[model samples]
Target: MRHLSDADVEALLPPPAEALRLVHDALVALSRGEAEVPPKPTVHAPGGAFANAMPAAYPARNLLGCKWISIFPDNPSQGLPTVSGLMVVNDGRTGAPRAVMSAGALTAARTAAVSGACIAALAATGAPAGFTGAGLQARSHLRVLEALGHLDVTVYARRADARAQLMAWAEEHVPRVRLRVTDDAREAVLGRPVVVTGLSIGLTGAELDPSWIATDALVLPLDYASSVGPALARASVLAADHVPQFEAVRVAGTLGEYPATTTWTGSLLDQARPDGRIVCQNLGNGLSDLVVAAAVADAAEAQGAGHPVDTGSA
Candidate 1:
């Protein structure tokens, strides 16, 4: 088996432009009935953290894979990453496990790719000032925005130090872009035409005041917190990878205070194609993980970045 580290995944994965294109194409194909992406299922252990299993296949790309991504947000309290896991790819033609890969990099890349795609799509409408948020996911959004050619950017976090770190990193790595740190989340979203929120809300998801947004701005909630929030349903368009995951949990009485529906995002996107303030909520579909994992794996192999593992020994 091939084992990819976060660094390896970074080196091998498609550049931001290519990655955005791939993700956008995947989304379009999904809308057009060319892919199978099941809703992600989560397993909550006795501990506070949870693990999720996502599986996806792209017939167009001949890629098949699953990603086992675990969220141990409390891990940071123990001086570890908040999220960690691995990706497993299989032979689409033959039923065989092809590789075991690092999940952190894959997750970040795919998540960023989604942001990049959204940025590009929104830019065609008219480029916004930029987006803001604080967290690893927020960093991913910033990276994606920069990659997708959004030059005016600002980030907001509760912590001054953390915001400073991100600002410094942005300056060093993506110089052409302007960066700012603010205490007001509303200030971040107010004038910007595009807003990406990537904060952890445990299993519940995060929420932002709709009033913070200008009329008809595009909001992308990468975190599941919005799953139960009124802002999600009240948005002009509510697009999600699967209505089943939330509906299932709601049926089971585990997902508290969220409405249940079979409303798929593809349908909503089709309905609200050209105009309106839209919100895309991702419950993190398996298809996204699978496609991204395969792309990263292929990139790693071509670039000779990952380590070959002797899975047989294990």
Candidate 2:
């Protein structure tokens, strides 16, 4: 087997334009019912940590993979990343594991790519956008917005240090964006036509007022009820990366008090109205992760990247 480290995955990843295209195609395939994504299964650990297994099979692409990732909220306190895991890609014909690779960078990139796809499919580019909760996801979103198209953005974070870090990284990586950092969320969401938030799933204790959103803004909340409120999701012209996944969560009670219903996928981009809230709530499907990781693995193998392993089990 071949093992791809985070660095190898990063090096093998395609350029932003191509990455966006790959993610876009994956999402469209999901919308067209060409992918098989089972409901995610989670195993809770101590101290509010959990490991989630997200498996997806794409028949059209002849790819099948799974990402077994964990979120340990306290890892950062120990100078470790909050999220870490690995993705395993299998041969579609024989179902043998072809590669095992790191998933942190892949997760961040694919999340932003999905948002970028939604933006290109539904919103206009070159306008001012807003961002809330600056962090790794925020950085990915910023890079993606510039990659898929150019847009000036204003970012607001609860922590000044986080905001500063994002600014510095933007200066180094995505310098084209005219980024404005603020201390509060209002500056990020008010009057902006497109907003990308760094809200993690299941977050609570703070709520963003619905009135703060622009009348015709497209709210791209990558998280669940954590960042974008349930009330906000219901009132808006809702869209999801996976309709069945959203339904699964709703049925499993993860949606809480939100009135869950069928959401607009990419296919309805042209029909999406601007008069109300245009919300893209991506609960994130395993299929998206599988496809992106598989691409990285395939490319890495072709280019003679990553560490090769013996056939014996470790």
Candidate 3:
């Protein structure tokens, strides 16, 4: 087995546009039933922390994989990353495992890719964008948003330091785009054509006023139920990576108080798409991880980013 660190995956994965394209194709394949996405089974810990298993098979990409990740919200206070995980890729033809690699970088890259694809497909170009919680997801969204050629952005976060840091990073990395920091989340989010927020998952999350959303803006709430309140979810046209996952959970009576949603059935490329204030709160699909991890595994095979371990030693 070959092992790839997060750095290796980063160096090997393609640029943002190419990354977005790859994941977009995977999602299309998913909607067409060419992929298998198992429900993510999360093991809950105390203090709202969790670890989950995400397994997927991307036959179109000729790979199967599983990513095991842990999200401990309190880790940051302990001077550590909040999310950490690894992915295992297998040969599509055979059941043999191929590679194991850190998934931190892969997660961010593919998420940005998926969010970018959503924005490109649903959002209008050259319009203002806003980000309501500045962090990794915010940065990832910005990277792909820049790739989409829409750069005028307003950022809002409770922490002034985080907002300032993101603005500085954008100025240095995406100088062509204009960046503004705002103190009011309502001011930053309400009227923007594109809004991205990373408030994360929680049961007691503060309720949001849905009227803040523009009539036609595309809101990508990467954080699941936290950023988007139930009011917005019930009001907007909803989209998700995999409806079956949520459906299964809902059927099992585990989706407590989750707003009503219908799974999106059409292709990601379909011309007749959802209109009005659209919300994408995709329950994270494992197939996307397999598709992206497979790419890094292929690159690792070619560039020798990781070393092969002798099976006999195991």
The C-alpha TM-scores of every prediction are 0.87, 0.92, 0.92
Scored by lDDT, the top model is 2
lDDT values of the candidates? Answer: 0.67, 0.78, 0.77
Candidate 2 Cα misplacement greater than 4 A, ranges:
269-275, 312-314
Q: List model 2 lDDT by residue over 84-133, tens digit each.
A: 89999988877778889899889888888888777787777675788877
- Candidate 2 global Cα RMSD: 2.1
Estimate, for each residue in 55-96, the C-alpha lDDT of model 1 and write its tens digit.
888876778888888877567668787788888987787646
Clashes of each: 2, 0, 0
Error of 1 at 281 (Å): 0.4
Roughly what TM-score does model 3 have, to 2 decimal places? 0.92
**Could you tell me which 10 consecutive residues in candidate 3 have the lowest summed lDDT?**
262-271
